[model samples]
Target: MSRLAIAAAAGLAALALGTAGASAQTVVSKIKDRGYVVCSGSQGVPGLSRPDEQGVWRGFDTDICRAFAVAILGDREKIRFVPLNAAQRLPAVQTGEIDFLSRTSTITYSRDTAVRFVAITLYDNDGLLVRKASNITDKKQLDGLTVCLQGGGSLTEKAVLETEEEFGIEMKKVYFDATIQARDAYFAGRCDSYVTDGTAAAGQRATVAKNPAEHDIIVIGKGTEPNGVAIAYGDDQLFNVVRWTFNALLWAESKGITQANIDEKLASGDAEISRVLGQEAGFGKAIGLDDKWAYNVIKQVGNYAEIWDRNLGANSPLKVPRGMNALYRDGGVNFPFPWD
Candidate 1:
């Protein structure tokens, strides 16, 4: 072959290889081009996802999505928050309407088959929200009660069934299209109690009730419900980004890294911190992101513990106890997956 022809063939081969590599990360490439991430959340469930006085989405779930935003784009505010009902979440993820579903979604066999679960970010159980006037202080007192529930494939709906079977009682289920609707029903004296995830139950009692002291949230099952962040099935490359970003929050908290102290930690000589913070090249290049991906997440959005405190603990009105949501070493279920 002529020298010129040989050179042209080599150049074409290199271009083909580059295109193939980029195409492997379809969801990531698409989001990068669009310049923002579509993150799924709940509709006006305080302590999970709800608008503040300024209409900005703020809560633990909002922060979970925000962590991914900063990890991928280095901008936590570059998020298009799509509030999803129970039925809408899975389809939105499967059809590419959102990057990942970060609502308090339980990981069941059916759901895991439909979409890839990034990680169980919240550990909770079903709970009943009751008015103190009703004098029903225990789950055993819930017999034959008319309960407000968000049915139609929601994990909250599953709570109804589980509660009935476990307590040996029947509940008259009054269903709603969304969580806020059900909470409203209970507040209007339509149902005896409102049933949902324990975290959201506390949110309703704290925020939606006429007086926070007038209501109580009673956790239903003794077993834990693992609520995961889900993405479309079969997108392994995108999965890696979302999964590690979720883990990075947990990892940051485990290592005593906080938004306030991250800068100091970054300057430390610790080898693991350096690698995780992307002071070295491997973590970022492997995920097709900037070297400071984990740093961006912790610095911009704060770690998992910080998010919980701001949204559900002392900083927020809810002040919900961290039961199963605490770290594994702290007598709860969450364990941070190692960065190595």
Candidate 2:
């Protein structure tokens, strides 16, 4: 065959392979057919992902799952949260056991290779929680103190070590198989402090402590933890849907759009607002859903601020400060990707 003919044949072959690659990622379609999304969670971590008294999951992580459900199915009530331990979190996503993970997992180099991180939903820090009587406000106070932490080379272990190194101090670490064991031991005075991610520490103090007022969350390393939404790799379509749903939440917050004001915003004449609200944009169609996907998220599950306040801030038992989790405009770290 002539040179041009050979080139044309090669192009056709490439197109065929690309088409097959695209067709293989059907997570979105499967979710649509199933009527809901399956999100992975811990057994119960107050202010994060934990079942309430009525057996319904409620927390920041669970609310993130709800946002995904709203964006994809347009139903705030349609979602299933399955409890998975630390060992099971990543594998479940890789094996299709869970549709995604919102268990306040920090984005790490090794984890990024195994699954696609949809977005940084929370900016957390590893911390040391001590009794109010201890008055351990400075890292200098941590030197030589025994800390109760989860063992097995987990992030908690790493956080404790990082604190020791950063503060120019050395700590005695007592590691346990499960966080509860470590926390229970800490409450029992087995150690001087409890080491874990800041949020988990806050949760433990709020829900497990005999007197929540006796404990305090002393943030460890500078906000090094970028907790993310994790989904399986090899499925860009599914990844984009989850990612943009998170973005929609942040974007809504950036524009001061709340659950109570979304309908009014939707009726506004602003073009970008209209597009983001799905009144004039094809965002949903571009991601293989109703144009009202973002609209549904804000309207039903609420914007990021609403979820945070209700789950981790003013409205919840934890009442943790927004800190790094707040929107950038509000003097925090969160910001939305451009909708256009």
TM-score of candidate 1 against the unseen true structure: 0.91
Model 1 residue runs over 4 Å out of place are: 1-25
RMSD per candidate (Å) reads 4.6, 2.5
lDDT of residue 187 for candidate 2:
93
lDDT (10s digit) by residue, model 1, range 1-340: 9999999999999988976786666788888898999999788888998887898998888899888888878999899988888888889998999998988888988999999887888888788888888898667788888999887767677777877898898889998988789989989999998988888888878887879898877777556788888999766668888889988988898999999999899888899998899889667987788989999999999988899999998888888777778888998777788666
| Structural similarity to truth (TM-score) of each candidate | 0.91, 0.91
- Scored by lDDT, model 2 comes in at 0.86
Q: Write the per-residue lDDT of candidate 2 for residues 1-340, one digit (tens) a residue.
A: 9999999999999998995677555787888889888998787788898888899998999999988888888897889988987777899999999998999788898999998898899888787889889888677889999999888777778877777788899998887877777888999999999988888888899889999998888877654789889988888778888889999998999988999999898788878889878876566777788988888899998889899999888988888899878888788888999976
lDDT of 1: 0.85
lDDT of each: 0.85, 0.86
